[model samples]
Target: MTDVRVVNEQAEQLVGAAETLFAAGVMARSGHANLSARLDGERFLLTPGFVRGLRPGQLATVSLDGRVLEGELSSVSAEIISMHSAIYRARPQVGAVIHTHSPAATAFALAHRPLPCRTEPMLRFGQAEDVPVVPWGPRGSDVSVRGISDVLERRPTTAAVLLANHGLLVFGPDSAATAHLVVAIEESAEAEIAAAAIGGAVDFPEGAVEAVRASIARVSA
Candidate 1:
């Protein structure tokens, strides 16, 4: 069993990240999503089903295999538990995961459209030029898990994806990075949508994608 105080701190951290999302306009209902961070090799801390007004003591500690190692009777969101578990299992390097329902981004997802990578923000911060929309699947089902898993596997460089008619999913090396990516995605989607209202979003100059990718590689190296 996880220590009470230790888990409490983790819960606070999750809430802090949620606050960031809330500020960025990614989420408001709180019931719309969840966040988690790896606790150890075998487990992670997940927010209770919804956290709009949840205290720090309300989070859950879940094992890698999907067991609720620690939490109350109504802790985990049954609809999204598998989605979170699959991501953690598939991406060992990811220390944090954020599920969001940012309106601009979710609008694209709802329309089954992809997020354009034309914006400088996306080119500089994201690995993929376009954020793929996952194939539609019933929420919380194995099909949903597989749809997300497959896209992440195929586009290992991208940190975020739109869940068809669902919302957005983003993971990163830590909470800060994940949160930044979440905000970036929201902004990018907003930009794309706004530009569409006038004419259409213009693509980057030829070879821009390669140049950005090269710069990122050099910086990381």
Candidate 2:
């Protein structure tokens, strides 16, 4: 497809995902989380800083290096430019990235706890073990980028991460799927809290994990 067509499609999808997330109450009224889609090998589309009431045309078009190729500079998530760029650079296969400060998951991050991958939704669409929690970093800093980059580099299959005292970041092959993952991570965190309130949740056995992974691989393939 033409560049214009691709960007428009990406813009539409990103807008839809953002609105869905906001409506689900995962995204805040504040400009906390943002979504991005790979427009090409060298460029991508990022959500506007304020997404709750945004239009598709308002999203920013940026290079893989975080250069604003199009859109108002004010619309970009300048703070997370490095975070998004680093993910694309580290994982060429990743087509979209999402950052959210969903309460449940962020609660886990605040406590420096790994989100257990016990629930079916998390096991199937999220990670196999506990989701890693990266060290804390001030907003829009190199430290934040590095914290996230380390996990993406070490665990290439990682679908989500809990940024210490920050929030959650998730990516996938498409904007819609990645957005779904953001929600799934929050759900897993909520489940963990509920389970802990009782006694503790049982983790999947090593063999059970392998079976589920194998099943997911076949279905995805």
Candidate 3:
């Protein structure tokens, strides 16, 4: 049996994190995103659908097989759960996953373009010059899950991936790390857009990029 207490705590934390993101303007007015974390050995705690703005006690627990645990909320996000399940199955090191439709990040995704790395912050997260886009599949379909899995399998060091015409998904060693990644990606996206407006060559200096990567490694270590 899953550990009920741990699941409940994770649920509460997930909701709280969602609310914090909403307050920070990272989430849309209707709560279009989902956040999740692993619970015990075999299950995950996820935000329920249409919960609107999240609150401390308003999350749900779900089994790996996608069954909703009783007594919490119902109505989970099918696509979100599918993506998270595939990620967890493929990457055992990831303890938390965050999906958000923050305007800047979603804008790049909708355009089917990668955000160019033009600053040190972008290099700090995996030294990725461009955040790759996973091709779209029918929402709530296993195809979406498999597509994302394939990307991660190829780029295991990637901290985030953009879903084509959808939004962004970030995974980390824990919820806090995942949250940090979301903020980093949003900032990088904003920087890339702003730099393009100037219409000149713009890139982080190599020495600075290496320094930022070293700092990130220290923190991650």
Candidate 4:
């Protein structure tokens, strides 16, 4: 059986994190994002739908088969839960997923251009490449989930991906790591835009990129 206590604790934590982001303006008031945490092999927890400014105790525990066991007052974010579920099913290493529509990142998404790795944070995250925009899938459609999964399958090391004309989805080993990636992606997007305004930015040298990757690997190990 799955550990109910652990699932509850993780769900609460994710809710708190979501609230913190919303309060800080990382998530918009119109319910622009959602967060989820894996709960063993068969279950996960996700934020509820239309619930602006999530808080602890507001998250719902959901089975891999999409059954909701808690927090019935709110519905799951349609595309959000599916997207997170897809990733968790495909990548057992992923413990948490965060989806947000932070302004700068969303702007890039709308433009259908990948944010260039013109800064240190971008390179440090995953050897900054053009954030590929997955083709538009109808909102709330399974197509978005499939598109995201396809991209992630091809680029397994990626911590973040931009959904074409949508927003950003970031994943990591756990909630804290996923949250860090969210911040990194937003900062990278801001930096890239700022650099573009100041003239074109330069890509990090191969040596620098290698050094950063090595350092990350050592620290992670």
Question: Could you list the CA RMSD of all candidates, in the order they appear?
Answer: 3.1, 2.3, 2.8, 2.6
Candidate 4 per-residue lDDT over residues 133-165, each given as its tens digit: 777897546888788889878877677778888
Whose TM-score is greatest here?
A: 2
Error of 3 at 120 (Å): 3.4
Give the deviation of candidate 3 from the true structure as CA RMSD.
Answer: 2.8
Order of models, best TM-score first: 2, 4, 1, 3
Instruction: State the number of backbone clashes in model 3.
Output: 0
Poorest lDDT segment (10 consecutive residues) of candidate 1:
70-79
Candidate with better lDDT, 2 vs 3: 2
lDDT string for model 1 (1-221, tens) is 55767666666777787777777776645457778888767788877656566566667777877788777535237567778777888888888888888888899999999887877666665535688899989877889889988988898777788999889888887777687788888898888889989998888889987888788799999
In model 4, the Cα lDDT at residue 78 comes to 43
- lDDT of each structure? 0.78, 0.81, 0.73, 0.74
Q: Compose the digit string of candidate 3's lDDT tens values, residues 113-214.
A: 877666565565443566778888865578888889899888777778899888988887777667766776787787777767888437666677667767
Which residue ranges in model 4 land beyond 4 Å of their true spot? 19-25, 29-31, 50-53, 73-76, 125-129, 214-221
Q: What is the TM-score (0 to 1) of candidate 3?
A: 0.84
Per-residue lDDT value at 213 in model 2: 78
Predicted structure with the largest lDDT when compared to the true one: 2
Model 4 residue 204 lDDT score: 73
Off by over 4 Å in 2: 29-31, 213-221
- TM-score for candidate 2, residues paired by index: 0.90
Candidate 1 accuracy as lDDT: 0.78
Ranked by TM-score, the better of candidates 1 and 4 is 4
